[model samples]
Target: MNDTSTTPEAGAAGSVRPTLAAVARLAGVSNSTASLAFSGTGPVSDATRERVLSAAKELNYAGPDPRARSLRRGRSGIVGVVMEERVGDAFRDPIKIALLDGISDEIAVIDAGLLILTDAGEAAQRIEDAPMDAVVLIGCSPRLDESVAMLRQRGIPLVAIEGDPADDVLTIAQDNREATRVAAQHLADLGHTDVSVVTLSLTRDRARGPLTDERLAAGSSNTTLERLSGVRDVFPDAGGYVTRGSFVEEGRIAGHALLDDPDDRPTAIIAQSDLLAAGVIRAAEEVGLAVPADLSVVGFDGVRVDGLWPYDLTTLVQPAIDKGRAAGVAIVEMLEGGVAHPATFTSVFHLGNTTAAPRAH
Candidate 1:
């Protein structure tokens, strides 16, 4: 008995994956007919489909390649979402989740899926080579110039969520400075003269520590810088810790560092994110300091924080999901040969139970 298997023979150059055209040729059918039979989208006869399947089995053909199909259609049906943080970190943050949901909501109209990519480490390669119809940047990354340049070189449509990217990229702007200013003014009106700020990442490194002069000068994160400027407008001497990311744990760390010292601690702390603010509140509790009584804490990004039952956090409620949807809509419009203008969103200040007048020492 002789073996008739189609395995690659020894001494042969690299084995080529069998193509659908070869299957069609063996089945005695045209390429289009073979494709229709595999996809089950056209009017191919059962007999013809059976023949095509049999030929495919014999040739070890797995069906039409998605890459080839995309090439033929001149569209990948993929929307790439690029962020500066790890994929896990991005999901951990609720604001990030909201933005993603918004983008998904709008892109669903075109039957497209999302491919999340990061600017650091291994995922950087995908940012340059992924087959994306368009891209949405999550925030102002320190490596924005490099990522934008590479994507633009590939001629992919670009949309930024809050980054100050190049002029060509359509930015979905948020009023970070104005909103933070409102929160700061609220603290000021309440007579919070000794105020401090807990900021987000100041650079792509996402380093955690006190905000030194050098760090402030080298800051590249647009959201952090903008919010910092807003707070400074009211409290010129405001200074606080720089967190690694928008996690409650990071905020707690900043909170401990600030609240540990009673003599030098500020009366109020303005956190860049709600999660951070929650952490600050926790730290205040740890040190026997009650929020709005001993320490006034203000947070941004009016997201619902779990386990925050007792305190209503005063914050700036920005339209996170709406911002994401706008970006997705812009990407779809650009892909369909329509113009997509840049969009700006405002944040409304919510008076919660977290902030109050300082008590005399």
Candidate 2:
């Protein structure tokens, strides 16, 4: 008989998978000691740790199964990130991408995986039933009160970005009202009395049309409402067109409608998003109007637009990544049995070439 034939093959298809118990037995240690050596949560002697690792290698034991560890800790080690819009649509925005990057960076440290859930199609049910340790709701609407209630019932730690869904949830709020107010006032100082606005969606229905008094009263999105109010603070009667989303095409549609009437066209336009601003710019060019010379346009959210050179967009530079990181830190604190407080971030005005005094006819 060959001695090599008698030796157990490590990780062979037919070989039995080694367990922590077998590793501990080979290392002459208790099961608890082996667990501590792997988890690093409890103290273990250096010599013992080395012995356990050496034994685990010989036995082909890959420490403990993550599933079993999660079960033992009573946590799934997964964080659910819920968005109000479809994942595909949400990903198109640079702000959303930067926010997600910040969130992923913070959560990676705790060995928690992210499970993205959107409140659309069949995935909406996951908002209430997902096996996650905590959840972060990004750009959620006040209309999601029922969903928030369900998540709360399930005992999931909740953090909301820029929405007031509930009083108990840790909120990472933005200074939407003040920032837009400042932007509007900038145009006002430049003698732009005939200014119009291009707004984001006001309701879940995403009805695109003029922002009527009735529609403004029934607005469900906190961000849209806040920014709208900010514009109203400067231009009380500044009428605007509501869009389905913060999309360029929607802004272009709004721009054409607002600019079609040359006699009644606004001297300036305040777009709620940078993408919308870019569309408004394109619409101006389509009508043979030069930016800042014939029409002055201002936008919010200082996101870099590809192919938008020769025009530095004058917008409010909000701390998008920092907002996401704040939310992530809040989630970590809550999950670690610590209290987390709500955070509010403000935006800085970035002066660029897109804005100037309205051209005299």
Candidate 3:
């Protein structure tokens, strides 16, 4: 049975889609010849190639089946990028966007595609069963151990960006602790002892509120903990609010909480990110306080903040794109059976007009 049965819907609705073997049979060629003709990878005569293509056109065949091709190759050609945040929320941050771009640029060499995945909600199921040749974990997700256990069971290559290092996993790290230490030290040198910090989410649930001792103890966000350690290195007793996410609005909320009381306001604020620093600036304006004049603010990540005019932020500028590219390259190398080493990046301090000596109260 050649499956040549035809129905009334064959003309407009497209016949049950002709297979490559069917095209080969109609072209009077072998199955391998038909494949070679389509792929142009074998030494098929031009006339024979033309005939095979003509038969394919007559039968309305698009090409060889991709699923079949992957089956033969034993690779799904998909690289999973696992993030802890929602896809929509992840793209809102320019840092995430830049990191993704870098990963895409390197993975193109293998002709592989990216499958954006998360470790929460409905997408969690995909983390366990989705077909992936390799995975790149982004940020420090509290569920990292569980994700690693499943992916390791599948024997997929793993590369983590800014994640806590584990056995057989490569981590692309940045100088969060050291960079923030330098930034905080700058404030300390300027005699700004009365300082507070605005930190990123420190728990899996991203609980928002004052950063209490209990919350600090239960924190698992590696990046947040590292940056906080850096701040503590300078101002050991510094305290402030913790945000649910890395957004300007969250920073505004934290800023208000820390700056509302004029009598007990700190002379300086160290925000975990530039966006948060921008929001803190807005909060200061709302409270009729001047930056560097009334309070000095420092930020991390050297990203461009929109509408932050007349004030160059005194912050740590990290190589976000480079970090991403390194992770991508490592993933590519590992997939090719080569050893990939862990990488650490440093952040440079940019002296901007945002920080100055505090005024006498």
RMSD of 3: 13.0
Predicted candidate 1 versus true structure: per-residue lDDT over 1-361, tens digit per residue: 7433334321134375665556656788754456556655344689999999998788776664447649777887677888888877886888887887688667655546567788887778878998788899988564668878988999999999997788778899999999999999999899889999899999888898998889999888989999999999999888899999899999999999998988889999999999999999999999999888999999999999998879999999999999988998899899889989898999999999999999887
In model 2, the Cα lDDT at residue 319 comes to 93
Candidate 1 to truth, TM: 0.81
Full-model lDDT, candidate 2:
0.82
lDDT (Cα, 0-100) at 359 in candidate 2: 86
Return the TM-score for candidate 3, rounded to 2 decimals.
0.81
RMSD of each: 13.2, 12.2, 13.0
Pairs in clash, predicted candidate 3: none
- Expressed as tens digits, the lDDT of each residue in 25-131 for candidate 3 is 67887544565576553456899999989987877866644466478777776677888877767767778777866776676555455677877887888888887
> Each prediction's TM-score against the native?
0.81, 0.81, 0.81
| Pairs with backbone N, CA or C atoms under 3 Å apart (clashes), candidate 2 | none
- Which should have the higher lDDT, number 1 or number 3? 1
lDDT on C-alpha atoms for all candidate structures: 0.84, 0.82, 0.82
User: Please, what are the lDDT tens digits per residue for candidate 2 over residues 180-247?
Assistant: 99999999999899889999988877889998899998888889989988999999998989998878
- lDDT score for residue 70 of model 3: 77
